[model samples]
Target: MIVTRDLTKRYGRTTAVREVGLAVREGDRYGLLGPNGSGKTTLIRLLLGLVFATGGDIEVLGLPVPRRVRDVLPSVGALVEGPGMYPHLPGRTNLELFDAAGPGGGRRDRRRRIGEALERVGLAGIDRRPVRAYSLGMRQRLGLAAALLRRPRLLILDEPTNGLDPRGIREIRDLLTELHGEGTTVLLSSHLLTEIEAFCDRVGVMDGGRLVLQDDLATLRAPTGRVVLRTPDADRALALLDGRVEGRDGDRLTVRHRAPDDLNAELVTAGVRVRELAAERRSLEQVVLDATTTTSADRADRAGGDPA
Candidate 1:
C-alpha cells in the first residue's frame, strides 16, 4: 500500500531521513519503531506528502506522492503528532467539522458517519462539553474518531496511543485488528515496544535517519536455538543432559536444544519432574536494540544541530 526508494529528506544542513527504502503491503499491520530524533515522524510526513522529499521516490496506494497525493489522500487517514481540534467545540462538533472539510462522504450521511466514528472510539455518550474540558485520553480518542470518519483504506498513525491508559490502548489495538481483518492497511509508528510486539505482523526499525531493519515480526523474533526448562528435578536433568546444558539457576536450566518438545519428552521419560519447558526466543526489545547503534540523546549530541 506504501513504498519508498532511497527516500531522503534534509533540513538545511541536517538530514532528517536518508536512503530509506520502505515497503508496506496491503492488509498489513506494519509497525515503525524508532527513538526520538530517529526521523520516524519526518518519514511519515514524507510518505503523506506533507513534506516533500529531498531525493528519491514515494508511492501510496499505487500513486506517486505529492504529484498525485490529492488522489491518494482521500483513501488515506493519518494522525501525526496528534489531531487538531477546536478547543471550544464538543467532540461531535469537531468530527462534524472535519468531515465537512474532507472530500469524501456526502452531507446526507454526515450525521450518521460522525456518530459512528465517535461510537467506534468509545465516545458515544459524550455530552456538549468543550474539547478543553476533556481528558487527555478522551482527546486522543476524539482524534482517532476523526481519522476514522471517512473510512480510510490506509491508516498512517504516529504515537497513536500517546495519552491513553492500558485499557484504552488495548481498545485501540482491538479496533485496529478488526480494521486489518476487513482489509485496511495500517502503518503505525510507536515507541511502545510491547504494544507493537503484540499487535503488528511486520516491523521496520529506523535510526540516524535510516531504515536499519525491515522484516516480518515473526522472522525477526525467531527461536534462539535454545530452550528454558523449569523442573524440580533440576539436578537429575542436568546430569542426564550434561553436555547440552548451557546455563542454570536454581530449578531453571537453559538447554542448548533445537526442539523444545523433544527435550521435554526426554526429560519426562527420564523421570525428571518438569514444571515448564519452552523455546527461547529473542524479544522485540533485543532485536531493536541490536539493530540500532545510537540512542536518541546520543544522536542529538553527535549531530550538534537540528532535530529530525
Candidate 2:
C-alpha cells in the first residue's frame, strides 16, 4: 500500500533520510525501528505528506504524495506526536469535533462512528470528562479513538503505547490486533522491540537516515545457532573453547554453533566446570543494535534537523 524509491530528505548539508525504499503491502503490520537520531520520524513525516521529500518518489495507497495526499488521507489515520486537542473540552466532544472534520459522511454515520470509536478505545464511559482531567494513558487512548473515528483503512501510529501502563499497553495491543483482523493495515514506529515482535510480521530498520534492512520479522529475528555457557572458570573455559568463542559477557561466554552437549562434554574433559549451558538466539534488540551502530561519522553526518 506504500512504495518509495531513493527517498531523500535533507536540511542544509546534512541528510536525515537518504536513498530509503520500502514496499509496505496491504494487511501487513510493518514496524519501523531505529536509534535516537535515526530519522524514523522524519521518514514517517515524509510518508504522511507532513513534510515534502527533498528528492525521489513516493506512492501511498496508489496515489502520488503531496499532490494526492488529500485523496488518500480519508483512508489514512495517524497518531503521530500526540492527540492534538483542546484540554478544556470533554473527550467525547473532542471526538465529535474531530468527526465533523473527518472524512465526509452523513451526520448519523459520523455519530455512530464516534460512539464506536470511543467504545472501541474504552472511553465510552468517561468520554464525558474533560480531557484535562484524563490521565496520560486515557489521553493516549482518546487520541487513538480520534484516529479510528473515520474507520481508516491504514493506521500509522508512532509510539501509540507511549504513556500507558502495562495493562493499557496490552489493551492497545489487542485493539491493534483486532483492527488487523478486520484488514486494517497498521504501520508503527517504536523502540519497544518486544511489542513490535509480538504484533508485527514485517520490519524495517533505519540507520544513518538509510533503510539498512527490511524483511519478514521471523527471518530478521532468526536464531544464530549459538550456545552460551556460564561457568565459574570463565578464563579456563575461554581457553578450552578457543576456536568456538564468539564473544563473552562477564562470566558468560558465547560459543559458536556447537551443541550444548558438545560444549559441556568438552568443558568437562578440559576440567573447566560449566554452571549454565543453553542454546542462544540473537534477540531483536541485538539485531537492531548490530544494524544501527552509530559512528562518529554517522553522528557528524546528521544535521540536528527535523522536518518542518
Candidate 3:
C-alpha cells in the first residue's frame, strides 16, 4: 500500500534522506528501524506528504504524495511523533472533537467508532477522565485510538511503545497484531529492535538516509551454523584450526562456519573435548547496530570526519 523509489529529501545544504526505496504490501506489519538521526522520520514525512521530497517518487495508498495528500490523508491514520491531546478535556470528548474536525463519521456513528477505538487500545473505562490524569501508557493508547477512529486501511506509528511499561508494551504489541490480522497495513517506526522483532513481519533498517537492509524477520533470523564453544584447550584448538577461531574467553572459543557439525566433529577428532556447543546467532539489536554503524562510518569517511 506504500511504495517509494529513489526518494531523497534535502534541507538547504544537508540531505536528510537519500535514494531510499521501500515497498509495503497490503497487510504488512512493517518496521522501520534506525538510530537517532538516521532519517526514518524524514522518510515517513515524505510518505505522508508532510514534507516534500527533493527528488524521486512516492505513492501512498495508491496515490502520488503531496499532489494527492489531501485526497488520501483522510483514509490514512497516523501517529507520527505523538498524539496531541487537549489535557483538560475528557478522553472521549477529545476524540469527539477530533472527529468533528475531520471528514469523519456523523455524531452517532462517531460515538460508536470512538468507543470501539478506545476499547481496542485498552482505554475503554477511562473515557470520561481528563487526559492530564492518564499515565504515559494510557496517553499512547489514546493516541492509537484516535488514529483508528475511521477504520483506516493504513496506519503509521512512530515509537508507539515509548515510555510504556512491560504490560503496556505487550498490550500495544498484541493490539498491532490484532489490527494486522484484520488486514490493516501498519508501518511502525521504533528504535527498539526487540519490540520490532516480536511484532513486525518485515523490517527495513535505515541508516545515513539509506535503507541498508530489508527482509522478513523470519528470513533474517534463519539459523547460521556458527557456534560458541567452551573447550578444555582453547589455545590448542586455535593451533589446530590455524587462527580460524575467534576470541578466547579463558578456555572458550567462538568459531564461525558454514557447518558447525563439521567443526564439532573435527574438534572431537583432534582430542579437544567440547564443554558447551551453543549456536551463535545475531540478535535483532545486533543486526541493526551493525547496519547503522557501518553506514555511519562510511558517511564519516566521505566527509573526512572522525567516525562517531
Candidate 4:
C-alpha cells in the first residue's frame, strides 16, 4: 500500500533522507526505527505530502503524493509527531470537530463514527472530560481516536507509545494488532526498539540519512541466538573456544553463538561439565543498538573520529 523510489529529501546543505526506498504491503505492521536526526520523520512527512522531496518519487495507496494527496488523504489517517487537540475542548468535542470536518454522510453517521473511534481507543467513558485535564497519555489516545474516525485504510503513526504507561502501551499494541488483522496497513515509527519488536512484523532501520537495514523481525533475530552456561571449568571453556565468550562471571560465562545445542555438545565433548545452561535471545534494543552503533562507528572511522 506504500512505495517509494529513490526517495530523497534535503534541508539546505544537509540531506535528511538520501535515496531511501521503502515498500509496505497491505496489512503490514511495519516499523520504521531510527535515532534522532536519522531521517525517519523526514521520510514519513514526504510520504504524507507535508513536505516535498527534493528528488525521487513517493506513492501512498497506489497514488503519487502531492499530486494525489488531496484524493488519497481521505483514505489515510496519520498521527505524526504528537497529538494535536484543543486544550480547552473536551475530548469528545475534539472528536466531534474532526468528525464534522471529515467527509461523513450526515450528522448521525459522523456521531456514530466518532463514538466508535473513541471506544476503539479505550476512551469511551471519559470523552466528556476536557483535554487539558487529561494526562499526556489520554491526549495521545484521543489523537488516535480522531485519526480512526475516518476508518482509514492506512494508519501512519510516529511515537505512538510516547507518554503511555505499561497498561496503555499494551492497549495500543493490542489495538494495532487488531487493526492489522482486519486488513489495515500500519506504518509505525518510534525510537523504542522494544515496542517495534513487539508489534511489528517487518522493520526498517535508518541511520545517517539512509535506510541501512530492512527485514522481518524474525530474520533479524534469528542470527543472534546465544546461551548462558555455568560450569566448574568456565576458564577452560573460554580458553578452548578462543574468546567466543562474551561475559565472565565468578563461575558462569555468556557465550555469543548460534545453535546452543551444538555448543553444549562441544563443551561436553571437551570434558567440561555444564552445571547450568540457558538459551538467550537478543532483545530488540540490543539488535537496534548493534546496527546503529556499527553504522555510526564505521562513519566515524572513515571521518577520523572516535568510534561509537
Candidate 5:
C-alpha cells in the first residue's frame, strides 16, 4: 500500500536518506530497522509529508505525497516523534480537539469515535484526566487514541513504545497486533530487535542512509551451517574436514557445513567414532547486528576525521 522510488532526503550537505527504494503491500506487518541517524525517521517523515523529500518520489495508499496528501492523510494514522498534547487540556479534550480538526461528520459521531479510540487504548476510564497529570505511558496511549480518531487504514508508528515500561510495551505490542488482525497495514520503525521479530513478517534494514536489505524475517535468518561433533579422534576429524572445522575443544570440534551426513560419512570413513553431533543457527540479534554494522570508515567520519 506504500511505494517509494529512489527516495532521498538531505539536511544541508549531509544525506539522511539515499536513493532508497521500497514497497509495502496490503496486509504487510513491515518493520523498518536501523541504528540512530540511519534515516529511518527521515524516511517515515517523507512518507507522511511531514518533510519534503530532497529528491525522489513517494506514494501512500496509491497517491502522490504532498500532492494528494490531503486525501491520503485522513486514511493514515501516524505517531512520529511523540504525541504533542496541550498540557492544560484534559486527555479527552486533546482527542476532541484533534478529531474536530479532522474530517468528522457530526459532534455526536465524533464523540462516539473518540470514546471508542480511548477505549481501544485503555484510556476510556480516565479520559477526563488532564494530560499534565498523566504518566508517560498514559500519554502514549492518549497519543495512540488521537491517531485512531480517524480510523486510519494504515498506521505509521515510529517507536510507539519509546517511553513505555515493560508492561506498557507489551500493551502497545498487543494493541498493534490487534490492529493488524483487524486489517490495518502497519509500518513501524523500532530499535528493539525482539519487538520486530515478535510481530513483523518482513523488515527493511537501513545503514549509512541506505536501504541495505529488505526481506522476510524467515529469509533473513542466519544460515544453520555450523555443527558440533564429539569424536574420539579430534585431530583426525579436523584434518579430514579441512576448512569446515571452525573450532576444536578437546575431543569435540565445531564444523561449519550445511549437511550433517557429509561430516558423519567422512568421519566414519576415516575410522573415527562419532560420539555426538548437534546443529546450531546464529541468533536473530546477530543477523541484524551483522547487517547494520558500522564500518571503520563510518567511525572515522564520526570522530571528525576522514574515513579511515
Candidate 6:
C-alpha cells in the first residue's frame, strides 16, 4: 500500500511532480500512465525514497518515506529506469551480487532464490554469458528477476516491459498476475496503454507534473449508453429501431440503447439477423487522452522547459 498527499518534487525551477495525492491500496494492480517526462519516474523515486521531495508527504507500506524507508524497503521491490548491472558479469553472478548487497534473504538460500527468480522471468536456461551479451529483452527480464528476487509484498515497476517483444511482454504480464494472485501489490508505470488496460484493476493518470485522475479501471471504462449492433439486416434493424439509431456503417449500427439484451431480443423478434451485439465503453486510451495535456517533450519544444 502507498499514500501521498500534496507530494511535490522540484529540481530548482522545474517541477517534476506537483500537488499529487496518490493512493494505491493493498491487493491492487495499479497502473500509473503518462507521456514522456510526465513525472511518473519522479513519483516512483519519491515513493522509493531514492529522491527527496521538495514538499509534502509520502507513505509506503504504512511508513513515512525517507525517515522510515529503510524499515519497509526489505518488503518492497522496484525497477526504476532500468536495472543497473556489471556488464562483464554473467546474469546469475549479477543477481548474486545484487542479492548480497540488499538486506534480508538468507545467504544459504541465495542460489535457490536466484534460480527461482530467473526461472520466473524466462531465464531459467540462461548460460554463463555476461549481461552485456544479452539482448535488450533479456536485460529487461534480468531487471525484473532482480525485482522478484525477494518476493516483496509490493512491486514498484517503471517501464517494466521496455524492449520486450509481444511474447515477452505477455510472459511478464502473466508472471505479474501470478504474483498478484499470491497477494503482491503492483504499482506499474508504463506508456503502454493496452498493457495497462489488460493488466491493471485501477489506474492513475498524470499530466504536466500533476495527478489528473485516479480511480477504479472499471469505473473509468464504464459503458456508454450505446450498443453496437452488428447485423446483416442493418437497414431493417435501423428501420426497426427508428430514431434510436444514431449511426450506421455497412452491417454495423450504433444504437442509443441502455440494455443490449433487450435490444437484441427486439431485433430477433423483428426478424433482424444480429451478427454481434455489445455495449460501447470508454477505452483506457480515450480516458487518458481526455485527462492529459501535451507531453513534456511537446512543452519543451515550445518553451524549452525542464525535464521531469
Best by lDDT: 6
Count of backbone clashes, every candidate in sequence: 0, 0, 0, 0, 0, 0
| TM-score of candidate 1 versus the correct structure, residues matched by position | 0.94
lDDT of 2 by residue, 43-120 (tens): 988999999999999999999997899898889988987888899999888888887776554577777887898899
lDDT measured at residue 65 in model 1 versus the true structure, 0 to 100: 97
lDDT of 4 by residue, 1-308 (tens): 89998999988999999999898988889999999989998898899999999999988989999888988888888898887788899988877877667553257677778778889998888746678999889889989998788888999998988889999999999999998888789999998777898899899999999888888888777644567889999889989877688888888888877778899899999999899887776667777888889988999999999875
Please report the TM-score between candidate 3 and the true structure.
Answer: 0.84
Cα deviation of 109, candidate 3, in Å:
1.4
Off by over 4 Å in 5: 104-106, 228-245, 248-279, 294-308
Segments in model 6 whose C-alpha atoms lie over 4 Å from true places: 293-308
lDDT (10s digit) by residue, model 3, range 1-308: 99999999999988889998999988899999998888998898888888999999999889999898877877888887777889999889989998888664577788899989999988788747788998888888889999899888999999998779999899999988988888889999999888998989899998878999998877777666567888888878888887567666888877776677888899999998888877777788878887778877888999999777
- Model 2, stretches more than 4 Å misplaced? 228-255, 258-279, 294-308
Q: Score every model by TM-score.
A: 0.94, 0.81, 0.84, 0.84, 0.82, 0.94
Any runs in candidate 3 off by more than 4 Å, and if so which?
104-106, 229-253, 256-278
Q: Tell me which of candidates 1 and 5 scores higher on TM-score.
A: 1
Total backbone clashes of candidate 3, pairs 3 or more residues apart or in separate chains: 0
lDDT of 1 by residue, 1-308 (tens): 99999999999999999999999999889999988988999999999889999999999999999899988987988888888899999888888888888767578999998888889889999999999999988988889888888889999999989999999999999999988887899999999999999899999999989998999999998999999999998999999998999999999999999999898889889999989999999999999988885444566678895433
The local lDDT score (0 to 100) that residue 69 gets in candidate 2 is: 92
Flag clash pairs in model 3. Answer: none
